[model samples]
Target: MSYSATDMIFDSEGYHQDFLIDLYEKLLKPRLVEEKMLILLRQGKVSKWFSGIGQEAIAVGVTSILQEDEYILPMHRNLGVFTTRNVPLHRLFSQWQGKINGFTKGRDRSFHFGTHEYKIIGMISHLGPQLGVADGIALAHKLQNEKKLTAVFSGEGGTSEGDFHEALNIAAVWDLPVLFCIENNAYGLSTPTSEQYRCEHLADRAKGYGMESHIIDGNNILEIHQKLSNIANDVRENPRPVLIEFKTFRMRGHEEASGTAYVPDEDLAHWRERDPIVRFEQHLLDRGILNWDWAEHIKCKIKQEIEAHLAIASEDRLPEFDETIELNDVFKVTENQYFEISGEISEIRFIDAISDALRLSMRKHPNLVLMGQDIAEYGGVFKITKGFVEEFGKDRVRNTPICESGIIEVAAGLSIKGMKAVVEMQFADFVSSGFNPIVNYLAKFHYRWGQNADVVIRMPCGAGVGAGPFHSQSNESWFTKVPGLKVVYPSNPVDAKALLIAAINDPNPVLYFEHKALYRTQRQEVPFDYYTTEIGKASLLKEGTILTIISYGAALQEALKIIEEEKIDYIDVLDLRTLQPLDTISIFASARKTGKVIILTEDSLFGSIASEISAQITENCFEFLDAPVIRVGSLETPIPFASILETNYLPYQRFREKLKELIEY
Candidate 1:
């Protein structure tokens, strides 16, 4: 009497007997597949497996009830999620075998890959980050008025992460449609819940955030399916975040290799007696819906299917070690369509130029969103967005809570669904708070799964405002070494507006560094209309034959001032607008032309962008050089009060002196 999944039905007594068998079959797939993988692990046919023996009910029950349009973020243990989604069995086997056709193309192993085709994103090795990404997708659903929701699963231990708290708070405050599922499988790796948290239940803390919370029996398939169906439906319709704690126990080791010796004999026996799959099977038998012979036949059919797929996966090809693939997979660079700024040409301040660019971008891309701390009515700390909220309204111009990590992940989430997001950090120094998602999540996500998270982070960097240690720092160099992240900085107002607009149009994540000192101090004839400066291209400020001054941001302004005030000619000034994908062609040509070079930067002299430029010149243009490259930068210490002490610490303090020495060398 068992029917197909399409015919499954739920009534007051939970799923009807016919559909109950269907749910039972769904639960059996993960259990049987995990059992087969354990044998494969021992036989050296597979690398690793995270068993979900006792917790199959949670993944199967929740995923089975979810609509096909809804998205889900599943942890490694949730094989049932994939099986329920009907992802090809051969592909699942291929994924575990690290085949080229696998989701990550053998670049990653186990369940660390995501495919948009399935609407199922796998978790990173870092457990709690995906919760925030889920929030991003749900936020997109809410803004578009779509009746779609996203469900994300984490272990009982993952709730202890700062990301978990931050994601929940952001979701609740925004009233996003997200189902936060926590499967309490008792142990986090080796440690138990006793050492994880003091809260009676993770769900109990959700009410404090004004979010709905519930607890369920994770081992009961019927109860879990019934509760999740209603809860998922309510949240999907009303669009609010809900946290559900499903109580279960880890029946196997975290992985097969980790023995269960730590789990006392009595506890192991206790949970084994209440195994989710076993209980569900017994329930079918008691209801006279399934007999012992039919149950054995079902298990046999699952085993045969697993073995057949494993054999096919064994024949799947491995990815070749192509040198270009390593470089190419990091980012997908697209040729930008140049926009002509024919509106007006007026002298604009650096801050106004950035403001103008964002204003125009918002008007152009209706999906463009701005997120930061106190950026809405306060118009940001710099007042660059002073009238933005009134013009664009609050939804587009958002003032986020002080959760920098959450802010970045939410933007990442927004980017996943074809929306543009710009995240503003209060200060460049505070990027450390949100560095994980930027480097690990946003940066490598494309490399791992061929997905583009198109978001821009505007970093207000540099010293000289008397903002002191915490607020003042030139930290743009930090992201330059990270692949899949574009770094751009502009010297003056014209270039600042151009570069900001250009970064927004790029298909990858970009970090736009705005120097605090140059915000109001520098003014130039910037286009009032729309235009973009090309990334990875250097602008020649002044062309000369004697020598070249290589710099960017505030440092370039200081170099130009020295040349004009001192009445020096015969010097080439090149402002490198983009830091990553450095304009080496321009630098090499300039170095080869003059046979002398001076690399100036606001970051400290040692291990700075200056150091990188100097190395490139020495290696690529050694024969043409007449003088060793001289570099000037801030003294290696925390930025101090912008008094005489600060002046001495800045690169300008020695620009004139260094220029004189280098010119005569």
Candidate 2:
């Protein structure tokens, strides 16, 4: 139902008329804060400002109903939510100023700060990813049988993203305790709502997911508070997701840098007249719950608080960069941590070894959860997670919709709440769809905020089995370039089990690339017990003096076969289990000893791991090199479907010739 200023309900049995005064005061604080922030923006004190001018009621109303321990995932414009969450004014000012006293310690200078103690998550620049993260937190609460629910905020623009659809679907199917709040502010940056979606109301999309949906008058603070309180309680008592669309308007531009030139003057005037804060304040006065004297007093108190905090925040020092940032600091776990082994040795395929490692990890860590498409009941397309559902039950092993972006972010959200999530990408190439969450959010968490996203993304990669371009791809090189991510590509069943175990236990985000080609092709003796290989250390498979062969994943087998068949006595083979923190000491030492080097990988020749290894070795061991560093990799083309074309594409014989030429050089 539509709510007008005069028609709005000011009194309810649950909340007295006095509550309207409190809500109006709460709404005024953020508007004053935003006005101050806009001034700071003009004065160069803050780099940017996103005003929640007309939309303050959405945050204040929703937060008013939330329990102290319940979480709220807020966006940049949700200043009202931050205020309600008891975030100190000075801390918010410090974050805006990029000061050391800020929550992010000057690493970020936007609305990107969250406190685990406060149960609030700061927003990443990307809009839609937080929805999935909320789903993950809600999932954790559900599994733990907690009475808490999670609320995530997004805008109308975010509904266009695949993550939004995916998160809503997962939450609906699994019956998660999550409230998806969409603020339809009529525009996404410069694009109007009419241009963004064809649907009449964004909430209508929730019906397709079989979820409860509501459309509320966002400008009515009292009505919003009353409705959200009941909805929040319902979600907490009977765990299921609901999507609420706030019919609001954005009074300001997207940011201070962006002017409101694109918005029609008439439309702006219409929303200006319906300003939630003004409307709420007038309603309170008309109801005789507040007077001009009380309103002025509240405004003065809030303005003084903002100015006082801004003064303190202005004096805060800037963060100094430290040069001694080590790999272990980012990874969170010490590389040299001792892992005790206990089970018998048995022969197992590459995929089964990975599956066994996951099982062992889950059995040991109760917080570990598995999520992927068709993974729970279907046991995954490759049967790697076969029989996992019967063992761990559906709560632990979940089957997600085909939404990689949502899946990865959900895993990230779970990680934030001290839950370890193992997210399986059905195919490695599909990672491109979810690359934003992986690179922008998950990979940057530890570096920016010193928070470890203790999640492992299992990517089934490589192209030898002729699955074509869509299914088969060696995308490890793409992630190896990202700074905070750990890239692991195992060569054998033993390393597969060991590395997966290590990645799971590690506190950083690890991209564990399991070769689809080697799933069932190779078998080796793998320990039944738990063990972890060093994440940043390379293993010396064979030792020699004349030449050093560096390879990993499927290419390591080719390197080994060539060495054995040719009876090469002067060759040393190094399996680079982890790619990002390349074992440079071992690589340089091996290069210096051998006097020659060859790097091999299954990826395309251009911008491959082989290129990285070759460049690094040449730079460090240039004086000792007897010959130029050589690289052997697949041809630079899409992986073909036909066996003959695929074989020609990934020619092992040609790779062997390259290795021979390097050895004899």
Candidate 3:
């Protein structure tokens, strides 16, 4: 239902005169600073500014009431949120100027940066995914038994995103302490509310999800502060998610460059009369708490404060980066740390290795959490985690809805808060559902803000099980092209166990591709105890100088069998356990020695990891090569379902032929 704070009484915590003046200052500082930024934007001193001229009350009111340690994930227009939290003004000005002292060191622009010190999580341009991140931090707070809440904000337009629905559903189901705040300024860029949603108010959408929701006069500072303060306290103590819609209007364009030509002149006039700061100023003046002389004095003091900070920030040097500074912080360097397994060897399959790694990690690290679709009592679709929930309890072994985007975003929040999370995609193809969060949020987090996303996405991928097009895929190449991500495809159980354990410890996102076909196909003597494997390293499976065959995952196993069956032992075989940060040293060393190289995999030939390997070998080993590098992979067409068509579509026989052809050359 729509909520009005004008009729409510603020009995005990009555709005004191000082409290009124404090809120006034909070609202006025951002308004004046934003006006200054518009001028700077015109002069080209600031790259851009998301003017929150008319919407200052929401940020100030909500932020001023929140506990200093409670995290708030804000939008680009939340300049008042930062100012209300008492963050250094010079640093904020530095951030706007793209100086070296900015939160992201100029790696990001505008307010797109998070700071642990300020308890603020930055906004991603794709606004909705951040709601899922709120679920994660709130989940962490609940798991730790901490009486804290997380507040996340969005515009009326962002509520239409799938992540908004997914996050709301998950938070309500789990009863997480989160405040899903929406500032309904009536337009998403240029699309009006009539085009955005069918509901009367965005908070009304919460009813379908069984969540408590409220609406306030977003343009009224007293109403926003009182209602938000009461609701935030209630959510923190009661432990449930709630929705709050504050009705305000953006008095300026979305960005200074984007004019408000689409916004009707009458609408702008209507909102200006109800301007937040002006309304709050009149509220104090009518109560005799503020005088014109004192008010002009306050505005003048704030103006001088902003100008001084801006002048100092303008003189600051821009970021001067180098190869080391640019390359570093993508992923935290982890040393090989584990106990050596002794004489007793256990025969294990690929699936067992993955299970062993997770079981060991969950016990070793109390902060480690696992999230998947049916991972709790159902044991997952593959039954790999059948007994996990019983051991780790429902809190650690979380069975998430089929919301892949929420899974990645939530995992990123956990990692950012000094914890680790492992997400299991039932089938490798489902990674597509979570791709945006993985690539946009998790991948660029460390590079953009020096915040490592320690998330491991276990992709149960590959073909040959007759699972058809949707279930089967060898699409590791999709991630090999992205920076700040580590991709590892393991052929055997030993590597799978060690790599997964290493991935959990590595302070970055990792895609661990486990071929579905190889899960039960082979058994090997793996370690009975713990051990760690090095990432970005390759191993020589066969030593020879005649020809070199580079392959990984199920393809490498098939290649080994074919060569042994045909008595072709003169070829050198290299197994790349890690696809990203590829073992160039070993690859080039073997390529130069053998002269002829064959790169094979199960992925499609065009734009495959095999193609990348072929290009690298040719570029670096051209002088040593006696013949052109050969690449063998699946056909360009979609993977067929029929056994005969599937067999013909795969590269099993083609790879063997290519090996012999390279040998003869």
Candidate 4:
């Protein structure tokens, strides 16, 4: 059955002149900005501009119904939504100028920017990332018992993207508090809606996901305002996702510079006649609420306000370089003002720490979930998720395919939706296959969008016990080079437990580097309660007066072993749990104290974790060092299959000897 045009409008809310005109003007701001921004682009003052010329009513009318605290995830062309959110007009212009003071501080394109206080989620350059992110945020809100709704906007063309389907499907399955807003403006870039999809109504797709849905006239601002008012309120109260398709038209081309040569002349003419801002203005005039002169004055006032904002925004200083470090790259569970410390009740292995951390985090927060290859019923190869499937069910403990890229992609896609996905890469050695998704895609997602993924990648890493090179290598250094990825490698059972809890609680994409050598071999008494080991802080296992042994993962055990064997009374040991936001403060402080240093890892010596550490230490604490920092790691060769060769291929015992040599030197 077709939805009548009148069926979309809500008559209860008075659509008076004041309200209608405000909606019309809000819709026009983006179009006007796009026009001017394009002029700047043509003049070489700006690089690109995405115009929201035809879908104004959808952004303005829908956003009008939302509260200031409700979250909005807008797509490339939803600049009008930001206009309603009170984003400064000049900041929008500065973004196009590629100025430091721009919305994304000159880091990302004008379309993808963020402002947390306004509760506006940033846009994703890719079509469907925001859909999943909205769901995740909504899930967080639901779990926290907050009355916040997450609304994600996208174009009709974006509906064809795989992420769109994945996000909506998950949102429905999870029953997240989200509003999936589709601004169907007849065409996507140049492709007509009919050519791209066969769905009779995009909103109907919601039926497959068991979600409530509606199709509305995008040109009718009053109808949009009235319906969204009720829908937003309903979502706030009940907290279930809804899909709304706003049938609208695009008056202008995709961007300012393009002539829109592919758009049919007839289709363009048809949409121009139904311009949403013009239609809404007429609606107000028809009700004897507004006049031509009054509308003109309003337009003039808006233009002046925009110009004044732009002038001031252009002058505002850009974010300082140090401001990027403000957010804690690693997250941890906190019960109160202090990190919840767990005491040792029983001796535990590395894998047990992982399982306990996951169980504790899930028990504490209902929003947490575990997913990856065989992680559900299989409990994962390492059993880090042993009983999660039974405890949380299949929805939370997802058993995914062997597609490494797909696993990370789906996890990343879902993280964007609002669920906390703890992805497992069977072994650390195989992590190379999933590196692109982690480095090029997921790692950069936060930096590109001014948003974070808040997901954990549990990779059992390092070499020992004859697992061979294929199952053993520690490849965390590869991820550490990426700007936004947080790398964590716990040394002891307690730190491992605390770090895992922190990684899940954190709102950033973190690489949880679990040493395969430590998974079952190393045992330490760990507390049952949850706690966090700070991401960028280093824990000094023992403080000494003479030399320092800096290491993490399996090497920490080697350092402790050597200290015991040599009866080294003045040696200091440090465990670096988080890398990326490397604990430089602790490292420099240790170096200053010891005056001698030895950095160790189980990976290849060249470009290893130690290499970066050595260079930074040399640059920062050069004067305090008595001698240049020495390092120990495997030789540049594939870890052999045999036990003897594997032992020789790793650097566990070698690092201990190297640290002694560094102290003697």
Candidates in order have lDDT scores of: 0.88, 0.87, 0.88, 0.76
Backbone clashes in each candidate structure, one number apiece? 0, 0, 0, 14
Considering lDDT, which of the candidate structures 3 and 4 is the better prediction for this target? 3
Q: Is candidate 3 or candidate 4 better by TM-score?
A: 3
Candidate order by decreasing lDDT: 1, 3, 2, 4
Per-residue error (Å), model 2, residue 92? 0.5
Cα RMSD of all models vs. native, in order, equals: 3.7, 1.8, 1.9, 6.1
Candidate 3 local lDDT, 112-177, one digit each (tens): 899999999989898988999999999999888889999999999999899999999999988999
Superposed model 1: Cα runs more than 4 Å off: 1-14
> Which whole-number lDDT from 0 to 100 does residue 436 have in model 2?
94
Q: What lDDT is reached at residue 614 by model 3?
A: 91
- Pick out the ten consecutive residues of candidate 4 with the lowest summed lDDT: 328-337
TM-score of each: 0.97, 0.96, 0.97, 0.74
Residue 342 CA displacement from its true place in model 4, Å: 9.1
Cα RMSD of predicted structure 3: 1.9
lDDT tens per residue, model 2, 1-665: 34444554455446676666677778888899999888878888888888889899999999989998988999999999989877899998888889988888787877886788678888888788889999989988988889889999999999998889989988998898999999999899999987999998999999999999999988888778878988998888999999999998898889867989999998888777788888767767776778999899999999999989988997899877775654334556545655766569999999889989999998999999999999998999998888999999988998888889988988988888889999999998999989999998888787677778988999998888878989888889889888789999998999999899989988889999999878898899988888988888999989988888888988898778877898787678999888978899999999999998888888887887788888888788999999999887888888899999999888577878977787667
Winner on lDDT (1 vs 3)? 1
Model 3 residue 61 CA deviation in Å: 1.0
